[model samples]
Target chain A: MSDAYAVRDNILTHHFSDGSGCIFFDPMDNSMVAATKPVEELLNKEKSESDEQHCHIINTLLIHKMITKL
Target chain B: MCRRIYGDRFTHSIQPSEFIDFRIGIKYPNFTRRFLKPQVQFSSEGLVPFTPLPADYAFAMLEWGMNWTVAMYEFQRVIIHSAVLAKDDYAILLPAPPGSGKSTATAYLENNGWRLLSDEMALITKNTTQVTPFVRPICLKNASIDLCKQMFSHGTFSETAYKTHKGDVAHMSPQRHSIEEQSTPANIVGIVFPQYSKDILLDIYPMDKTSAMVKFSENSFNFNFLGQQSFETNVHLIENTRQFELHYSDLSEVNAFLNEEFCK
Candidate 1:
């Protein structure tokens, strides 16, 4: 089964107009993560290790408590 | 002197309303030397009082009181500490530190066909591109007092109060057109951080969004206090509006640049 992760509760996303990236803020953890559109989209998708990069990113965020396994 | 010059600009009403929003007053303490050395004190709702000033500074106290009232009570909109002027519904925000000559530039721009949205506080709406107008007089300091008066010989100014904390201070009434259009809101088109220098050529520099966002957050009066709402509004605004830093000495050249760049 592919690993799926979603943004943790209390995480807010803001898309930048310059197409650089978006900021994810978690007030409870007092953290802000800059992510690209694809990364954010992957965040809402079903857990899948099919894309190793996306899976690694979600796994890293999970370690940081910024995301959770779906 | 202030009464003689800016009396007409103030909205004088003797009628008291139960729905009072801001109750600000300046009072003098009664003591043996009260008549000899008259002192002025400012308070809102009789709390958070300020130290006394000389009698000549009554007008300055009043102006500061107005600013305090708005900053303290007006929370519906995000308040950015900056000078704002607009033309054709496109507003430019000039956010700067003290002694940046922002007010001087604002006065010149307002006189030259641009509508003066605000000289101090920019009332930005929550989660929108609009900025509500404060539409009050601009505060001019020290050398700027003489500079503005020399430029606009016929302009109305409150009497100069010297030796205050910010040195000499005076208020310049916005043009009649600005006050007349006070009710209208303007869509923000850009943010300009101004820096003044003596006898220097005008210079324009493009600012990156990250830096602009950081500076705006710092300059905003209630950015952190409003928390998530302020964050969302600021991000939205920065994403949509262009940002710049303007360094200049001559108002004429600066005006030319602004007209060509944003006014169209």
Candidate 2:
């Protein structure tokens, strides 16, 4: 039920040069998940009503240790 | 044939080394059929015995078993199924599936001027762009066997083993310099996906870095196993290196193109 969440720059979020997709990498435990369109939109600061859904996805990933909670 | 071809290669090593890194003991079962036509099985430390092959093809089995051991057991580096050759500290990754003429191009490139890092795999560090050398004999299969012999006449080659899974196969001896400088690490400059085409002269297609990264990740042996480290390493590689899809028939043309592109 933690609320605060932030993606870091170093190894957390990787922006692709070819615009294919970004990947979120966890350094603590060698885990990774491909960024979905919703995640990308959130990351790019695009307008969307699915903000809670995107955050939920990230939070679920955090629960799985695929990402970290800020 | 393996011993005969790689005899001088072993001498290049300063310290005493075994004929093969993996001590695979080849044994034959005793039976009436075994006496009539013997079969050779490969067994190593802690590994179950591999299926038996005809006694004549024992050398080929040993070579394949050794390669399998490395590809399966080694997890330190992200092993890419590619042929790597280097020149002036810049490495060229030749990644392709089987029968794509990767080995032939590698053999030609190594003999011409480029130093051979490995023909089977490129052991790349997960944290950095550093590639470790697993210098061994370059395997030439099917038609490549004759082509290699014709192209590099002076190069020592093993006796051809016929009709064992991949048709005819032989081992091409690596250059003395490559063996001596086996431990030297090379920075990757370009990743080329080469395809041999009879009609094509030389078709070079540029690849996007992200697409190239996906392809590289797909071709890696332990990319999934290494996880985040593999991701970081791949990202580092794609960001810093050029990627291409080269369809070539002529070695000279390919060599010239590589020289013009990477050597500068």
Look at candidate 1 and give me any clashing residue pairs. A2-A47, A2-A48, A2-A49, A3-A47, A3-A48, A3-A49, A4-A47
lDDT by residue (B88-167, candidate 1, tens digit) is 89999999888999989998999898999999999999988899998887999999999999998888888889999999
Q: How far is candidate 2 from the true structure (C-alpha RMSD, Å)?
A: 5.1
For model 2 chain B, give the 10-residue run with minimal summed lDDT. B10-19
Please report the TM-score between candidate 1 and the true structure: 0.81
Clashes of 1: 7
Clashing residue pairs for model 2: none
Interface RMSD of each: 3.1, 3.3
Off by over 4 Å in 2: A1-13, A18-21, A24-39, A42-70, B9-21, B29-34
Q: What are the per-model DockQ values?
A: 0.18, 0.28
Local distance difference test scores for all models: 0.81, 0.78
Local accuracy of candidate 2 as per-residue lDDT tens digits, A1-70: 2244456554466677766566666666655566544344544444345577666656666665654454
